[model samples]
Target: MTDMRVSIAGVKFKNPILVASGTFGFGHEYGKFYDLSELGGICVKGTTLHKRDGNPAPRIAETPSGILNSVGLQNPGVDAFCAEEMPFLKRFDTKIVANISGNTLEEYSELAEKVAAAGVDMIEVNISCPNVKAGGLAFGTSCTSAAAATEAVKNHAGSVPVMVKLSPNVTDITEIARAVEAAGADALSLINTLLGMRIDLKTRRPILKNNTGGLSGPAVLPVAVRMVWQVANAVKLPLLGMGGVASGADAAELMFAGASAVAVGTALFNDPYAPIRVRDELAEYCENAGVARVSELTGGVKPW
Candidate 1:
């Protein structure tokens, strides 16, 4: 039998398929569709130090092959998640990854401490959020800010692994990857979301209330694969690749490109069972490819 298990920074996942944060919520809603334990891991919604009302309405819009969203990290805050959501997620056998975002170094450090102490299997730091102290620039956009954020979280994360999520909006993702790695990040997740926008032709105005949003879907797959490959070459840390993964082939492609694991995002909006389907399909692919283990697919691509 092909070995589907993969470990990211010592945290073992039953498989390489994970549901991206903001798409999977806390896994409670998706639990009714299938057995949550059947998959690998779940990156819970982006939580913050305090509850956020999120951006204005009409925060989502359909594009050609994907959707643009400016949800603004709507969440119940870290305290509520630890007190309420964590218990529900612990019931499942799958790994629980707390995806946290903050506006400052202090907030990230505090969030990391609380969630790690609360017993999360991993902490996925969303540095795509703007850094208030850095003139509103995203921490992931600059090596210095990114490294600082990673260092702050690592200082308080205790033993739980800290995985820094990199933004695609930057010019050089590999540079940011190397910075976070040097700052003590145990693993890395890439291609958070590309900056995009939509407009109504007749109205001569933007479609989303926020004017612009992050684009996610099959549209960003190529970019995601490229960034993953580049970062994999640049850093020694394991990578959790995500962007537009919708099928087992897509997952395999990302793995081949360099992802130690993959996450399903916008696909979940259309099919709640996408993660399970991807896992099963990936297993089938490995079996057909005569592969003994799925981990072998990581960084398996050959350059011509």
Candidate 2:
């Protein structure tokens, strides 16, 4: 089984490194830089039932080691995705997971149904997107709402694997994790960008149009690892950890912390092919560590 791969929610991924949603931009942008098919899969930009204009300009701000953005899930509607992005993306070899957002439970259920019916390889119920309203975090921060949102979508996700993306803005990630698990999430993606902001000292003003935005980049790596580890322990579902993951070292660290897979976020912004390089590094690391498969690294942490 040296060449065997991992399957999450009945969907097979060629590897364990995926490009996180919002960062990859439908996988086509990165395809210009490298062969994304070399990686495991791609979580596309978040889509709603209708197209979104997103927030105003000055949307992104640079922090010390991280960046804050309130792009506001700016994507063509779910129907447009099926007609446009999907046809082009399906031409690629990698699996496609449609990331979806909605303001209410009914909206979420309807969005999931539309995307699932569109034949995406999988669906990530985007309960934690920081850019939108309906208290996006409100649906993800608590066990009650998290479970309810997950359950609502789960009922209609059909055969497509439904992974609930969790917010890092919560008090206890594990509590939310367990709640979604009980709601029938096939897998979990953790640490959707942490809430943060930046100030332009020179301008004496907040940098972003939205006073605060989600922080993502190398600075968020450690927090992502901790949250992934905590949530992985709390739920039996597979976990995809991301946020501030930029290098092979970061990938290995998260895998060691119990991530079944990892998503490359801001790193994609810097190097469009960062995901491929990280995957290559992981393969070499697995070979060097005398490990037959990268999956062996999951939970291989040493007790402190």
Candidate 3:
């Protein structure tokens, strides 16, 4: 039998397939479709320090092969997550990774402390959120700001593994990866939605209410794979790769490119069972390739 288990920063996942944040929404709705324990892990929705109403309506727009969204991190806040959501997620055997975002360093630190103290298996820091203190620049866009955010979370996350999620809007993702690794991040997740937008021809205005939104879907797969490969080479930390993973082959491709694990995002919107299907397909792939273990696929790509 092929071994599907993989470990990131000492946290073991039954497989390499995880549902991305913002798409999975705490795994409540999807849990009704199948046992949440069937997959590797679940990166819960992006939680903030306080409740957010999110951006204005019409926050989503359909593009050619993907969708653009400016949900603005709508969530029930960290306190509510710890008190309410955590208990529901704890019932599942899969790993629970709390994906947290903040507008300030203090907020990030506090969120990390509370979630870690609440007993999450891991913490996925969403640095893509704008740093209010830095004139609204995204923390993940600069090495200094990214490292600073990672350091602040590390100082309070206690023993919980901190995995920093890198944004794709930056010029050099490797620089940001190296910076976070040096700042004590236990692992890294890359290729957060790329900046994009669309406009209505007749109205002569943007489609999404927020004007600009993050693009996610099969459209970003190539970019995600390339970034994962680059960041994998730049840092020693394990990577949880994400972007446009929809099938087993896509998951394998990301793994070959250097992802220790992979996450399914936009695909979930169409098929709630995408994660399970990907996991089964991945197992079949390993069996067909005569590979005895799935972990062996990480960074397995060969350059011509």
TM per prediction: 0.97, 0.97, 0.97
lDDT for model 1: 0.90
- Candidate 2 local Cα displacement, residue 120, angstroms: 1.0
List model 1 lDDT by residue over 168-225, tens digit each.
8888889999989999999999878888889999998899888888899999999999
Clashing pairs in 3: none
The predictions' CA RMSDs to the true structure, in order, are: 1.6, 1.4, 1.6
Where does candidate 1 clash, by residue pair? Answer: none
Badly placed stretches (over 4 Å) of model 1 are 130-137
Residue 295 shift from truth in candidate 2, angstroms? 1.0
In model 1, where is the ten-residue run with the lowest total lDDT? 129-138
Measured with C-alpha atoms, the lDDT of residue 300 in candidate 3 is 99
Question: Whole-model lDDT, candidate 2?
Answer: 0.85
Q: Rate the local accuracy (lDDT) of all candidates.
A: 0.90, 0.85, 0.91
lDDT of 3 by residue, 31-129 (tens): 999999998999999898998778887889999789998888889999999999999999999999998887889988999999999999999999974
Taking the tens digit of each residue's C-alpha lDDT, what string does model 2 give over 175-235? 8888889888999988898888788889888888888899999998999898888877778
